[model samples]
Target: MTTSSSDSTSAAASQPGRFRVGVQKFGSFLSGMIMPNIPALIAWGIVTAVVVNVSEFTEAGWEPTNALAGVIFPMIHYLLPILIAMQGGRLIYETRGAVVGAVAAVGVIVGSDHIIDQFNAALPAGEDQLGYVHMFIGAMLMGPLSAWLMKKLDAVWEGKIKPGFEMLVNMFSAGILGFLLLAVGFFVMAPPINWLMAALGTGVEWLIDNSLLPLTSVLIEPAKVFFLNNAINHGVLTPLGTQQADAQGSSILFLLEANPGPGLGLLLAFSVFGVGAAKATAPGAALIHFVGGIHEVYFPYVLMKPALLLAMVAGGMTGVTTNMLLGVGLQAPAAPGSIIAVYVQSLGGGVGNVVGVTFGWVLSAGVTFAVAAVILLSSRKRDMELGDQFSAAIAKTEAAKGKSSSALASLSAGVPSAAADRIRTIYFACDAGMGSSAMGASVLRNKLSAAGISDVYVTNKAISSLPGDADLVITQQTLTERARPKEPQAIHVSVNNFMNAPEYDEVVELVQQSGDDQAVAAGSEAPASSAEHASGTRTAVEPRVLTQDRIRIRAGSATQEEALREAQEILVSAGAVTGDYLQAMRDREATASTYMGSGLAIPHGTNEAKSSIKSSALSVVRYDGGVDWAGDQVRFVVGIAGVGDEHLQLLARIAELFSDESKVAQLEAAASEAELHALLSGVNDN
Candidate 1:
């Protein structure tokens, strides 16, 4: 399938402007540093909640001097900041970068503490002492900066170190550089960051005092549609909110951006007064946004008719004003802005606090719904005449977010009715051929297999490698535009999450019905049952490719790269491939993700590295905690070195086994390597 050059060019020209893209990227980066550390923050919040009134627990025979109270200060003052720095550093330079970044962060932390103490001592008699300044801002700055510098330094000495002395040189060089960065952070970074945080806090206090904080919704609501919500919430608000929470036990700053009220109101309005696809999908979208806490679901509705943004802003202001008037706030950041999370965080303040927070969100949601309903009703006639703009708005939302989300895919317009019969080959396309696309392909393939549909072939590829003959092309929403030009004749489906999307079920239903219709038209017998159509013959031969030694169970957790290396090492030891195949495997992953879904990942070398293979073989390892495969959980890693089509039969058998939910659970719960190997070998029986 193909599109005309003119149509493709026009579509490209209509993409979100450069400035919006830049802002979204910056916001994503900022949130990236904080998002990974949220679990730690949550842990701290829990501890704080428990110790807020330790005296209350004494009635239950709890000791007054409960040592658990000590965990509160160290976690916020030291552990969290360092973890954020290490994560930021890891993003820039991996492990070595993380080490250096941590060293630099410590310097700033200690320097700030010392400064605070000195200021307290110098104050006039009986004056209030300044609170300790947490160095989160300093950590965010120094972590990445130090790692980048270390990366540059390492680049300069690349290939210069003698083979045997490499370790010594590398260690000393990193140590010396880390020492220098530590001193630099203490002297240069801490003071400015401390001052900046103080100024920002003062500004926020002024706004609250002047009753102008609600006006921030004008900026926040619009920025959220552009996908800047994370940057504003985590990057700017979380840090400030944490400080206020530390001093006063709660902070309204956390409620400002994390409120789900505005998004709920907007989605409700669409459900009640919208037209066409927008109206049809709104009710479900509202469930996801308000209950599932995925606010991105409602972004396209606003984009479809931008005038609706006024309703969002009004709702935001109402929520803020209500919370402010009630003097209610959360003890911690309410991530995803879910009502459930907000209530959980409000628990420490007792029932009155909970009621106030609840009332605030309800009032905000009501106002937003009222305003949006009016706007939608006023434009209903014009909207109906103008036709459905939901699809275009979805595209714009994807463009702004810079990725396709499975959440949005559920709400996207369905595949054209006619395309169902034409879809014989379904290709899941992504930037790299490895990750979500492979997972989506595997999932759809399993469905087809179970449905007794043998004619359809499901596969995955990088967008650049998509074949023109593709009958159906599935991609993340962000990549749909790029994919259309490559296979314009094929039906294009955009999804945010590939593992589980409602669209996949709709596609399956369509294909099955289409097959039934074709059978009726030909006056032939109905299609065979699922059991009758299942492929592969039961084999008596013992498996040579999967041996007991090649299987590992309960392997400890490791990063994606580490797990990949371990898989390749097993293959190398078996003489299936040369050591160089590891790099080729990495190159293949770099080109596209290799995640096959269902808690499995198959990492293999690229076509160009075929010469490195000595024989066909497979290495399997089970990670108890699961490997983080490009943000997806992969419990089983299978490293492959195939010679021609020799491994295809094995792969098919494995895929078939994983397709069964009960079998996947068994694999995860396997007690030993031999037990795991026995389950894997059983694939040949089918």
Candidate 2:
């Protein structure tokens, strides 16, 4: 069922091609900083648009009212830059880095202002003073730079401080570093950044003046397909566009990458002329792409046939040219590049502006649709002969994006049954392959083993290390997107909690069904059912892991962190692990929630912290009032410290005990610690 033809494209994405890895990583980093601050940018845009008309700003002797000047100017000059710096700093060193980054940003802001004031003072009496230079580029540079320096400084004396003087030394060192960085940012960083931004702005203006701006579509359309749309639009273009908009009240740069017309047209062409699953899904994908503002929906279509890239480029050029000729522009960056966002930003520029922008969008889509239709028609015979390439296209798209996309997943929902039958290798991925993914892999492995599904190879891996040949990939919902690109062929699954996700049972059922289907297809007697053997062996045995003293019923409610600490204290008190393991548990939870679903959460230290383990042990606590474990109601909390696979036997038994709703109810209703212990220990008997 796999498309062998896509192997080349998939390999290309897995390796490197025209795009440099360093450049992509840098673009991703820039978008990471800018994406979080988009709300602030949008708000600033709306306020500016509403306070004074953009058309009026173009007239001679025009000036903003005090309300507009007071709110609008300060937001671009100060608030936005500080927020961007804080986010950039946080990315580098967490909250402490964020504080230092903000401090450093302020220094650059004031320095740029000082430079502007000096230049304005030198201007002749009749000439207008130069506009204030926004320090966006300065913030982007100083934020991560200051935070990284702070981190390096902290590493110098880490764990070397004397007992109680640790706090004093840490506080003074960070303060001194922040102060010095502020001075450096003021003197050394601001001037060059301001000049660079000005130079870039001038370059963009030159392109527009020469009517060569449309040619940028050659780069932008291709980059968008490679998943650099956000990085290009939000990271580089938005900052430059915002500056232009502040001065001119509108900027064509905002429309450069944010125009949704080309994507809409490409999707429209697919809807009309595509084949198989792609044809069936194209209409829906087009809707999501054009109006929903998720441009990713169309990327897979382009990746399916890279020849379509030319069509996208042509469409993009047409949009840009139309906007340029009509003198139409957005008051702000049209985030998500949706038609709605474009129209909203086009307001306050008068009816002519709105009409012109709309016309440009329509023309772009029309041109792309025409070009893409011709391409699709030309290849219609070959495409039909090749069968559906939708799945392969999705794989390529995810590979290029460096992550799985939900939009792409929705397109392939009709064919899960086909993918399920071929499931042989499954991967459980997480940020670090040490804790959550490992535990999840263990749980799924146990399930598969019980089902006599020894043919399936299940293992845990860091998302970055996923092998491409996996048939199925399971990840935390938050990380599914990140895990997708690593193994584009895998049937990716997302779960809320790794421990007891309900999806586990469904996956087991799917495997069982697929096995049966394969046996029937081979025209042989189906293999003996393992379910009977598994169910019939429910006999009681002495509980080595669950002692009466270690079980607690009707424990008081606590926060998720407090519950984790309680679990850690119990394990520590039992002499199973060192006190340092508590921090490891906290660190593991920070990476991913330990919630196991089914009113159960198993809190454990990471694999790296296994050195702190003294012995294998388990502690169980039942919170009748219920503990909120990361938005899930948890009635049972289990703390585990395993030497190796010794703890997994009991852990598997616990998973089985929680798998049934009736048994879970019995455990929950247990009145005393002894009753709960007996009920838990009964899993071994079953």
Candidate 1 lDDT: 0.77
Tens-place lDDT per residue, model 1, 561-659, is 678778888998888898788778877765545665678888888767879989878899999978777567889898887775445446656766676
lDDT of 2 by residue, 1-686 (tens): 12222243565664564354445667877887887788898888788776666436555324554346568888988999999999898777666677899999999989888889999899989898888878877888889998889877876765477879966986798788888888988888878888988898889989999999999999999988887665667666888888888998888898988888998898888889988888888899888888888988888899889999999999999999999999989887777778899998998587899999998989999999999999999999999998787877776676565444567667756744556577666678876554456567767867877877655556666787776867778887656656666775667777778877666776786577566433222102212221212222223333555577777765577656557767887887788889788778766675567777788888877657879889877889988888866446888888877675445445546766776689889988888888887788754453
In candidate 2 the C-alpha lDDT for residue 138 amounts to 84
Q: What is the TM-score of each candidate against the true structure?
A: 0.74, 0.76
lDDT of 1 at 122: 100
Instruction: Give the best candidate by TM-score.
Output: 2
Instruction: List candidate 2 segments past 4 Å from native.
Output: 1-25, 54-68, 152-173, 416-418, 429-434, 442-470, 475-642, 649-686
Clashes of each: 14, 3
Local distance difference test scores for all models: 0.77, 0.76
